[model samples]
Every structure is written in C-alpha cells, then in structure tokens.
Target: MIGYVTIGVSDMARAKAFYSDLLADLDARVLMDLDRIAFFGQSMGKPMLAVCTPYDKQPNHPGNGNMVAINPGSKELVDKLYHKAIELGATCDGEPGQRIPDRFYGAYIRDLDGNKVAFFHFG
Candidate 1:
C-alpha cells in the first residue's frame, strides 16, 4: 500500500483553500497545513491525501483520470464536504445527494487541478 496521494495543483494557496474546505469534514485534525503542501489524513492512520503545489502544469490540468474518493462515513459528512467545496470556489460535478447509477450516494467536486474527488457514504 502507498503512504499518501500527492495531487498536483497550480497554486498552493488555491489548493489549500479548496482542500481546506473539502477536508473540513475532519476539521484541522486531519489537514495539517505546511509550506507547499496540504496534508490530509484519517485519524489513527497515515497521511491519506497530499494536495501538492504544482510545478510545470497548467492551472487546472490533472495528469490522472483517477480520483480520490473520500469515505465520509455518513450522509452528514458527505453533505459537509460537498457544500464546503462549493463554498470555497470548487466547481460542482455531482451535487450533494445520492446517485443510483454507481451505487454512490455521494457528491463529486473538482478541485483546483480539475481532479474529481468524490465524497461518499456508500449506503
């Protein structure tokens, strides 16, 4: 298994803003702010996501089609992440609600790098 997912972004400030709001489900307990990276983790586990400051790529270009789906644990956490992402200027993909297609009762929000990160409850 890997240690963390370092997602590249153009601006650390913008990445911090989006992720700060996105990861607010766990509050500052999980997201530890640093110089160029926004580190996020689950309680009692290793660092889960690292929104890294971009180097050479365009502002919103994501190099991967893969997305990091966050297991929010409940409907409330899913709602929190969805709303917060929009509140922090993230573009909404799948709104804060349920989806019958993928069995994903979740929301999808694209971050600064245009990476679709899903917040799911799976129930």
Candidate 2:
C-alpha cells in the first residue's frame, strides 16, 4: 500500500552516506540520486526511503510523531540493524527487545537527520 517515505534532511551528503552504509546489509542501494533528492531501496517497485531538501527552499525539520518502520524479516536482523544504526551515529530511541511477547520484536533509532526509524519483526 505504501510506495515510499520522504524525509527532509539538512545535509544531503551526510544523510546519503549514513543511509547508504546503514541499509547496505538489506541490499538497498542508491536507486536514484538527484540534485536535491535521493531514493534508496533494493529495487524499483518495492517500498523505498527518500531523503531531500525541503521543496520550499526553507530549512528542513523532521515532523513530530512521524516515523518510518522497516521489517528486517527476523528478530535477529532487527538487532543487527539496530546496532549498525548506532555505529553509524544514530541515537537509540528504543533498545532491541521483544515488545510483544511471542509476537513482535523491535528496535528504534533516530537517524543522523533525527528521523525516527524502526526496525522490527512481526510474526
């Protein structure tokens, strides 16, 4: 149902490098890199994450209460990506753990641009 989520960033270079390295294990790459925007994903047609400068030419800021959640396919990958995000300079928003007994396991972090991203597994 969702195609892509766009997050505004103040620094394109840092944001691009941060995501490129962080999502590499998921096989996501720089699918598109334009002047003011870039898209990353495993491929076209699948869901993607985009980073861009605010279109109005004003400063960019992350929207409160907005977040992007990614399912890494397993609980183990959730932990792996969570750690990777931290190593890449993301601040931990939530630790890796089973949020719902026998059902959900997840971790959360704020990317370099302060965008909330969640890695999770749902069974």
* Number of the top-ranking candidate, with lDDT as the measure: 2
How well is each residue in 7-122 modelled by candidate 2, as lDDT tens digits?
99999999999999989999999899997999999988999999999999999887899999999899999999999999999999999999999999999999998899999999
TM-score for each of the candidates: 0.76, 0.97
What is the Cα-based TM-score of model 2? Answer: 0.97
Kindly report which residue pairs in candidate 1 clash with one another: none
**What are the runs in model 2 whose C-alpha is more than 4 Å off?**
none
Please report how far candidate 2 places residue 75 from its true position, in Å: 0.8
Listed per model in order, the count of residue pairs whose N, CA or C atoms clash below 3 Å is 0, 0
lDDT of 1: 0.73
Q: Report the C-alpha lDDT of model 1 over 12-56, residue by residue, as the tens digit.
A: 777776665666667434446677666777643664788776655
